[model samples]
Structure formats: C-alpha cells, structure tokens
Target: MTITVILGAQWGDEGKGKLVDGQCQEAQLCARAAGGNNAGHLVRVNGVSYSFHLLPSGLINPTCLNFIGSGVVFHVPSFFSELAELEAKGLSAVHDRILVSDRVNVLLDLHVAVDGLEERELGDAAIGTTRRGIGPCYQTSRARTGIKMTDVFYPDLFEQKVRRLADGYQKRFGELFEYDIEAELARFNEYRETLPKYVVDGVSFMRSAQESNANIVIEGANALMLDADYGSYPFVTSSSTTLAGIIGGLTLNPKNITETVGVVKAYTTRVGAGAFKTEDTEEIGTKLQEIGREWGTSTRRRRRCGWLDLVVVKYSNSINYYTSLNLTKLDVLDTFETIKIAIAYTIGGEELDSYPADLNILNQAEVVYHEMPGWQKPTTNARTYDDLPKEARDYVEYIEKFVGVKIKYIGTGPDRDAMIQRP
Candidate 1:
C-alpha cells in the first residue's frame, strides 16, 4: 500500500500500535498526525514490549523512517523520556531515523501543571484529561502564544515566550500554578544541541516522501469519537482525531491517502467521562473489562467497557470514511456466551437521525442491540480465515456487513503478527 491511515474507529485504545508495527515492515515513512503523549499505542515485538507515547510505533521497524508531524502538540521532556525507553529496549539507530516537524507546537511542563489545575476547577464536571498538558498546550497553540519547535534553539525568543506563557497561567491560577520557568528554560537549553538534528519542515518532508513514492503509514492517535470537532464536546481531546486530522497534521494532500483503515474491537470501550449509550455497568461490562484488560496505555486508567456500538462506529466512518476495517481483539470475546452489537439508538420510542451531539440526549437514548452466538473456541491459534470456527466467521461476516466495510484484517491475539490479512 502506498498510503494507509490506521485509525481507531471508536474511543481509542484500539490496539493501533501492533497494527502499525505490522504494516511498518513494508512502509518507508511512518508519521504521527495528531494528539500527543496523551495517546498510547502498545506494541510487543519478539517478546520485547514497547509502549509508544510521544514517538511513532514505526521505530520498531529499523528500516522505517518516522515523522512527528506539524499537527502534534509535543513536549520535549516526554519525547526524550520515551525515546530513551525505546533505546533501552534495543531499538537502535533511532536518532537518525526519526524527524520532527519544525512547525509543531511545544508542550511545556507549565502547561501540564495548568492542565490539572483546570480540571480541579471543573470539579465533578471535569473532562477527565490525562493531565499530560495536551489540552492546555493546544489552547496556547490556538491562541498563538505557544512555543514552536524551532523556538528552543533561540534562547531569547524561547525564554520570552515561556515567561509570557507562565505569566498568563500564573495570573489565571494564582499561587495554584507553581512552575519554575527558569528551570524549564534551562532544560530546553540542554535539549537545543540535540533536538535540531531531528527537526524538519513538514511540507518539504512530505514533498520528498511523495517524490520517492514512499509507502507511508499514518498512525492516528486517539479516536474519532474523541475528536475536537465531531466528538462529544468539551469531553474530547485537543486535536482532530479523524481523517481531517491526517491532512492538517501531516501537511499531506488527501489524494495521497490510498486506504483509510478503521481499527475496531470486537466490542467497544471508552475512557474518561462521556454519555455511552451502550455502556454496560453490569456483569457483562465487568467481564469485558477484566478479560480484555481494558486499561489505557497512556494514563493507566481502567477503560469504561461496553458492547460494540455500530452507531458509534458508523458515525465515525461517516467522518473518516474507512476503506476497510480491522476487527481487533476478537479473542477477548471468546468466553462470553453471547456477544451484542448496538445497531441503533432510540429514546421516547422514536429513532434519531444520527449520533446526536447533545450529551443529555445521548444519556436518554436507548441503545437497540442485536445479539449473536459467541465462538467459545479461542481465535488465538487461527492463522487463516478458515482456521476460525464457523461461529467466529459468522461474527466477523456480520460486523463486515453491518459496518459496510470488509474486515480486511482480524486480530486474533495480542502479538504484533497475530493477525489474519485478507487480500
């Protein structure tokens, strides 16, 4: 594939890392479009487990060059921390292989401090952010007061900008915002010598990739339902986490995208606070969580579990336009006696036109579900489509039919290569 975007079809945590890692073997360029270290993609390679936060999952493929695009809100300290971890895990020659966008916004530790304070101010109405400075950093970015990637190299400009940002936050939060700007600048002074080596102009970088006809893989962080514009308002992540993000984040042309592959779990899950119409707070929900080990990779918080909601996925597809689907974590549902898929939503005995944006309306919406027979047999051993039991095949076929997209790849296990690809 020339250009493929692997996106989470629901509310993130869809095992995108393993999928991107597998695809990276054939890819020359792997780029992260949106979000920040708040998004995590875990990939296990040859018994070594890697958790990618700020970095691209493609680093595991030594031959695949990586790009952290302009649309990202990057924190330098987190970047080095993650990079050092990956290096210790035996991924060598990493420094020469990855590039950062010069136009990318910098996420400060001060911003991270502000993030928690803002959430505290909201009290019970908080958006349940990861407190990694994602929201605050993006806020500074849009307001045009944030530090750019290239600013770190200029001492005066970087210091002036950081002080201005710190002053603004200090005024907003008073003594509650206790950040050492001098220390932050000093840390940046340490980063300046090293970071410039990896910086690149995003437009020119993608232009070169296009000229080479590189097999580019765009790894989407977060998910469509958590998008800034389309997702649940105020509760959503900072950047656009859908197909629209891929273009803005990468500074790439839409025509360059050859395939938009949506990664969906056999069941659905979401993190933080939101009105989940199909949210199962009962035994089935607990079972899905415990069996699936549904904890977030970034925040380490237990994800809110529920049955697969096609209403959510279909709404996501309408925005991202997935060419095919990757039904992941099928084996997680192996022990369940029956599996359910939410087909539609209704409240007051009337069907709604689409996924209503109003959280109040969503809270009152009744999820209309369709149940299916579970394949008690484990799918972990299946190497081919026929290897799966008929029940499992039926489950896959039904999802493919319902979603209006072929399930081109089905993940049977947690390993990076434990996937069946349909040609």
Candidate 2:
C-alpha cells in the first residue's frame, strides 16, 4: 500500500484538514505527527462542520485508524474534551478508531499557566501564541523534566514528577497559579484510568502497518513555514512542521513515503505573530477576509490576508519537496476583478533568491507582484477541472508553472465535495 503526507505549504491554515479528510478515503491509517491542541483543523463532511485540535482528521472515516504520534505534546483535558464533542456529533466509534502514542509529551495545567504568563511578560513583543501550553510543554520536554503519556500510568512516579514540575513552575514564575500538587495528581489518575485503551507503542504499530501494506496518511499540524527550526523563529511554533518531523514521529523510513501533497490557499493568510511579507490591509484584503471567513479556527483571530505568495510557496516546496500540490480556497478569489500574486521579494531593491527566515529581513522585504485577470465567476460548484472558468484555469496553470509542481487537487469550497481532483 502507499503512504502519503499532506502538509501545509503556506503558514498554518492552508485548508489541510479538508485535504487530509479527502485523502483518508484511500488510507487504512491516518496520524498526526507534530504540534498539539494549539493548531486548529476544521473539516466539513456532509454539511456538518467539525473542528479538531487533538484528534486526527481521519477520524471522520470510520475505517481509518487514527493516531496521535510521539512528536505531539498532548493536553489530557483537551484530548478527552474533543472526544466528547465528537461523540455528541454522532461519531461514537472514536474510541475504537483512535490510538495515542505513549511516547507523546503531556501538557499540564502548570504549563498552560506558564504559557499565558510568559506571553503576558513579552507584552508588545508577544509571539501571539494560542496560550494552550505548547511552548512551555516543549520547553519542559527539552529540559528533560516533562511528563509523557505513559508517565501517568505509574502512580508513585507520576506524583513525584508532578510535584517536581509544580515546584519548578513556582520557582520560575512566582505563582503563575495555585498549582495544587495533590489535586493535579488526582486529575492525572483520572486520565490514567481512561488512557490505557488508547495508548500504544506507536513506532511498533506503524512499523507493523507498513509490513502489512496498510495505506498510511500522515496529517501534519501547522505548516512548513511555522516549523521552529526552518520557520521565522522566536515567533514560530515549538515543533517541526515538515517531512522530517513525520519521519521522526512515526519512526518510518523515508522510502515508505509515496507522495507528499502540499496544501496551499489561493491567497495567503497567517495566524499569530510573524512577518507577513504580502499582507494587504486594504479593501481587497478585507473583501477576501470577509468572503473566505478568514479567522483562526482556534483563536478566532482575524487572519492577515494578501495575494498568493509564490516566493514563499516555492521556498516551501524546496523544504518539503512536495510531489503534488492541493490548491485550496480558489473560490475566495472569485469576486476580485484582478488577482495579485507575489512572484518575488525585493529587499533594498535587490531580488532575493529565496524566502528569508530572519524576521527582521522578512519584515522589510517588499513583495514583487504580478497581476492576473480574475475569474469573477464562482467555482464552488465545479466538480471537474474542465468546469472551471477559463481565467481560473489560467490562474491555476500560472501557479503550477511557476512552482514547478502539478496541482493535483483544487478546493472550491469548504465542504467534502468541494474539491476537484485531477489525474
């Protein structure tokens, strides 16, 4: 069987959830590799919209095995809360389909407290995190003082670790909150009781899947441009959001990867703080925002919208080596008389060869735009590639040619049937 990785080519919210959900139809197993509840994935199936923070998007597909990989920093409360929400939505088989990697780092209340306090301390220079304890949890993991999914299964060891972390937080943040060690231990025990059925030796599980020729689809959180090591740093997330992360998280051979589909929106949008080189704060920008409903699924913050930044996507292609592209939100641009695309970045009047990683440089870089005729006509109902307006077809062709990657799937709307798949 084949394994494919569906990743965001732009900053997070490149409509990865819909693409991942679509890909689930052919796969036996689907897994999330990085990040945590900090990332939001919205998927609409059969007219009912579902939002995911901790669960894999593949949970919508009953036959698919959904997993949270070792690279994730899972918050126990959010995990259970999300499951409850899914149950209420009638997907009652969630428990049977989902498996949690025992090696995942756990995010505790103390970590969430520290996250908010730290962001507040940063004040005007804050990175605009989700305050979901992602940064603090990863920090503790790197510091070798973090808790794992399996840690809660052992009572004495779990209590010792919680006390140590609580003491550490108090010493570091000077009363971020009243973290009662005993109460926290009681909560941990509750989580431990329910976690046994879900927790698994993930590496072994994936290896076995591979051996059994199960088609696996890895659902990546965030995007390549938000990766801590390669993205605009300090303002970036605390995890790897690239191909390397998936391989490391799942303990899979790179050769097991048959395809890598980079999901991108028709225009650019990013949440949180970072340099947005092509951001437009004008009328067109606001129109796109209104039409596209450009708001963070988790934070509900308005996303900064602008022209499609090919320079950034080209740079992302280099990083992820995408085998194909899934162009999403094409309908968002239907009302524009003319569509603008940032073909290159000019810094100090000199064209840069690649997208800059340094926040300072990126903040100053000017977008070199290329204007194209807009389709103007709505494409949301188009089920085939030939059904798109000629102008829309041309726009897609231009992007495909410039990025040097074939556009395999085109997203016309937010629903499950809103995509056009090309041969």
Tens-place lDDT digits, model 1, residues 308-342? 99998888888999999999999998988888899
- Clashing residue pairs in all predictions, respectively, total 0, 0
Q: Candidate 2: which stretches are off by over 4 Å?
A: none
TM-score, structure 2 vs. true? 0.98
For residues 1-423, write the lDDT of model 2, one tens digit per residue. Answer: 898999999888999999888889888999999999988999998878899988999998888889899999999899989988988898859889999898999998878888998898999999989999999999999999999988888899888898888887788778556666677778887877788999999888888888987888999999988899888777789999999988998887898899999999999999888788788899978998999999998889999998899998999999999999999999988889999999998888999999876667787888889999998898986899999999999999999999999999999998999999999
Model 2, position 333: C-alpha lDDT score: 88
- C-alpha positional error of residue 241 in candidate 2 after TM-score superposition, expressed in Å: 0.3
RMSD of 2: 1.2
**TM-score list, all predictions:** 0.98, 0.98
